[model samples]
Target: MKTYCFLFLIALSITQVNAETSIAILDFELNDLTLKPRTAAEINRTASIKPLLEKELKNAGYRIISIDLAMQQKANSGFGYLFDHNDVAAELGRTAGADYVLIGRLHKPSFLFAYIMGHLIRAKDGQLIGNYISETKGGDEKLTLKGVESIADKIDKDLDNRYTPPPPKHTTLH
Candidate 1:
């Protein structure tokens, strides 16, 4: 009975330690567009990149807060907020109850290519955890999704590097 109880406690502790990190991803700001007469479809396609990024982060064992919720919080806060502003990002993280915040911009150098740059920020103190930049070539939809995925992969690797636990020490019998 005691052994079983000990095993249960160990399992509970392990589950707590392995809890998924919560993150909130903001919309990617658009910049330097070369597309002539941006259509509604192109704008919508560009906006959809946030969800792809969230899905990738979720697959990487992160809990994602909804972008809508984050935006609403920003609107309620009554400030001309910027994602690069640490205080604003941190406040959004707190409002959304996220452990970290991901914010960045998308640049379209031409009609056929898109570039994305992202920054991962710690919520508690608003310190920059890491940054990633990636580019993809194609139409708006394809390029935006591909660029976001590449950035997500970079962020996933960064999280893995930061959060992976070290191996337990071994002791040999003397």
Candidate 2:
């Protein structure tokens, strides 16, 4: 019985250690609240956030899975549909064989500032892990990139906290 229990424990630990968390990052949608027409720079800035975020998350040891563009558009159904529907996002992530899905929005409430908002959702169960936000004071590429980095940092922290294995117990030798 003792040997059986020990073997079971070892197997469980090995399973935990071997499990890799995979994520799909959808292109961030732009929510321009400002009355001014969206400029080429703002549009370009919004487009840049996803790749930077994917790179950051990949460096953090997550498996970055690509969601098919046609499928994503199909899942989106309409403008802002996928961003508003995390369940739909999760379904898309599941289709891509990802453990998590990151849906983001660059919300420009004014010309002076924008908020980078991300929703992390578990694909298996469609539960939201959290909403992470970072504020950029300017519309330049540098600041917007910084905002994406900030959101990625927050996500790493949250996921690490949630999934990190407990420290192995130290047995003392007499």
Give the TM-score of each candidate: 0.73, 0.84
Location of the lowest summed lDDT over 10 successive residues in candidate 2? 160-169
Q: How far does residue 151 in candidate 2 sit from its true spot (Å)? A: 0.9
Q: Name model 2 segments beyond 4 Å from true.
A: 1-8, 161-174
Candidate 2 per-residue C-alpha lDDT over 4-104 given as tens digits, one digit per residue, 9 for 90 to 100: 99999999999987777888999988899888757788788889999988877777678899998888987888878887788999999999999999998
On lDDT, the leading prediction is 2
Let me know the TM-score candidate 1 reaches against the reference structure: 0.73
Candidates in order have lDDT scores of: 0.72, 0.85
Superposition error at 68 for model 2 (Å): 0.7
